[model samples]
Target: NLGDALAAETGFKIEMIPLPMKRMGPELISGNISFICYTLEAWLPSVKEQVLWSDVIFNNQNLLVSLGAKPITSLKDLDKKRVGVVVNFYYPNLEDSFNKYQIFRENGPNNESNLQKLLHGRVDYVVLSSLEYQYQKKLQPRLNAYDLGIDTFGVKCAVSKKSPLSVSKINQAIAAMKKSGKLDRIFRLP
Candidate 1:
């Protein structure tokens, strides 16, 4: 994992704290935690404004999922279609277009459920991370996907505004790992 690689590369002990999504920002901003990684700036705008971010750790592409028989390649393809989305996930540039086309937005607990919605024909399409779609597709082997090219977002590691760790130091460590290809190896990056 990138976290483990970062710790080893930096010669620092890193602890993983699993917290509720809403709690992560408040905790980080208050310095209750040292740093948090694998987040999108759009997912936590207020936290982004108050924290230090490392270079992109990875990119998450938001994809459109529909039945293979009826694939959707773009937002315009979603006009008047029922679309499933997980609660609390933001669809950046596509939302306004989805709205303008009067796309029906259905909410699900998570990606799997939205995927199930697509499989069962309960929704016309589902918006999900490409990573998740690929993982699920391998299991089901019947899921369909089309790249929503404009919806790619960067995932970053971030430190608190007043943490003991220096942002530059963390960035340097990440850069070193990148240079040595440790990050690509750990993440199986292409």
Candidate 2:
């Protein structure tokens, strides 16, 4: 849908290329990838000089999720618990907790892998973006999402400096959409 909207506004075909989380930074720095959205600029600090970050697309928060019956309502509830997570992805707010070994991190390849781990009882809890949790909730209604009151950050589009499409052009289209309410409509889409 974003590709369709971008193509309509920019006259260029928007091709999405999927890369492993581990390879994303390297690929972007090497100009082998154009862009990725729903990403945090903080995650790409190593390649900050080689990438262009767009305006904030939306705000998102990190939530602790579990099966409805096993609701984890607060941070204290996570003490010494193993939380499923994406391998190599940083959880900024949890760094201190992780460093102190107060909570354990159980790595998986991606969100789906982590969710599967949770559902299959491989882990007691998992972290998910607010938007992602909402989408997953639609498919599995027996899930509970708990906010830790941390890790709230802006989500934005990250464009490689070597991308064929300039950030300015992309920004113009997004700005237009934001001003005309198209962006809001997209977020509200079922």
- Number of the top lDDT candidate: 2
Model 2 ranges off by over 4 Å: 69-73
lDDT of 1 by residue, 1-190 (tens): 8778878877778898887567778898999988887777787776778888888876778877777756666567777888898766668776776667678878887777887788888998888787777677778787788886848888787788877877787888878877888877765656
Please report the TM-score between candidate 1 and the true structure: 0.84
Model 1, CA-based lDDT: 0.78
Per-residue alpha-carbon lDDT of model 2 for 69-125, expressed as tens digits? Answer: 456666777898888988877888887888898999899989999999999988888
lDDT of each: 0.78, 0.81
True-vs-predicted CA distance for residue 98, candidate 1, Å: 4.7
Question: Residue 92 in candidate 1 has what lDDT?
Answer: 76
lDDT of 2: 0.81
